[model samples]
Target: MRRWAMQAGLCLALCAGAASAAPAPTWRGLDPDNTLVIDTSQGRIVVEMRPEFAPQSVARVKLLAREGVYDGLLFHRVIDRFVDQTGNPNNRDGGTSSHPNLPPEFDFLLKPDAADAIASRASDGITGFVGATPFSASQLPRPDGTLRAAGAYCAGVVGMGREEDPGTGNSEIFFMREPSRRLDRSYSVWGRVVQGLDVVRTVAIGEPPAHPDRMIKVRVMADLPATERPKLEVMNPRSAAFAALIRKVRAAKGADFSICDIDVPSRSQP
Candidate 1:
């Protein structure tokens, strides 16, 4: 029965973007150990990660970033009002990484509100789907007879990390092409395009001959000196208030678990 409960918990975490499977461990929070700042010819874009949420994926990116693996990498694929994908060491064919395929880190119930916030949306109220699963909530959950604000899942063009493909994430990543209301609960969003969006908009679209955009280098802004780095302060979810909320929620739910068990929301890139 304990084993079964563990399995059940694992399943729930997978749904929440926490664990990929029973065998793999989950990420803790931002990989301050290996943060990155993407430098494009057009401009620089900063990314703050949450390794606690997806540790394996974050470690994989750090490994690649430190080796300068993504340096001179091309944004091999781009779609207007959509995503730009890269990470193929060769920028040709489906990119392969040194790591093995990872399991899905789903942590659904852990952060329903945040998940809803990032979910993709259509012009109509209807929600979208990915891999045959609906991403966002069409209606709000009211468990105690009280009205709750309608919540959504992650949407829009999100930074893509490998799911079910462990080490497969290496240096490759993708941006959402548009608001993906349906994908809110399905994918793990590592970071966002905080700057140089215009350059991303101007990326050469289409496959091959027309694929002109490329990532010259990717660095972590925090790692740089104050004068050289951009003015940015990533909200540390470890703050006292944030930690208190997690305790309150867990206590209210009558659950005994690590604070890491709660899904902390990601603040939008400024």
Candidate 2:
């Protein structure tokens, strides 16, 4: 009995030590100069914002997150095999941030090679590129028989979330509808779902009742007390293969591929 108790005590002590050593959650690939961490009740959603990419949009989101404006919100929109959209703080109708909406920041004439080179160079620390860039469907070449650029304006397919009226994205945000290949070059992908995807998947939908799933609260890691502070790590820029692939696509077509175009590899548990 004494031996068993000793072993149990030792295990508990080791577990506590391990917990203390665990790294805190953080936004990856974030520029220390400007970044925001969105802490939801479900888990932490880190955002490495690019004010240079979309200044007004990033500012709005940062302001909302910082002011505790998104607390007690819900997911609101969750489609199976698609994305889960949120940012409605009120939980009544769709919620907008404290500030007024701005006009759209659409730049449809980005050159593919130029964009690729810029991204590659930026990742190499050669230059500083912040904020998200805009894209248009007409830039992507069709893969089918036509082999021409598809001229569709599917906004929110790849860039920062905003309404059609440009500068309309307030507190509300949406995830990808799917692995959208068509959106590869036309939208700014600010961040991705790193954890709690299952929570997103499990959110209750709305229709007849019109309640939809909601976020209980949204907090920023920086806002939390030091005892509850999260650890952060920056993601390395695209791998060589990824960078080369972008170059190849840009050469064949006339647009750069969005991060959504890449497949996420599966990881094994330790």
Reference-based lDDT, residue 238, model 1: 25
Local accuracy by lDDT, each model: 0.47, 0.43
Error of 2 at 237 (Å): 1.8
lDDT score, candidate 2, position 35: 44
Candidate achieving the largest lDDT: 1
- Show model 1 residue runs off by greater than 4 Å: 1-35, 106-157, 161-170, 209-211, 233-270
Q: Please, what is the TM-score per model? A: 0.55, 0.53
- Best candidate, TM-score: 1
Model 2 ranges off by over 4 Å: 1-29, 32-35, 92-94, 108-164, 181-190, 194-199, 207-213, 220-229, 232-235, 238-259, 263-270
lDDT of 2 by residue, 1-270 (tens): 754554344334323422445442222233433445444544544444444344565666667766777666676655565556677665533467667765554432322222211222221111111122222222222232111111111222224455555546566765554555454324334444433444544555543125555555555445566565434443222233433444665565545544333322212121
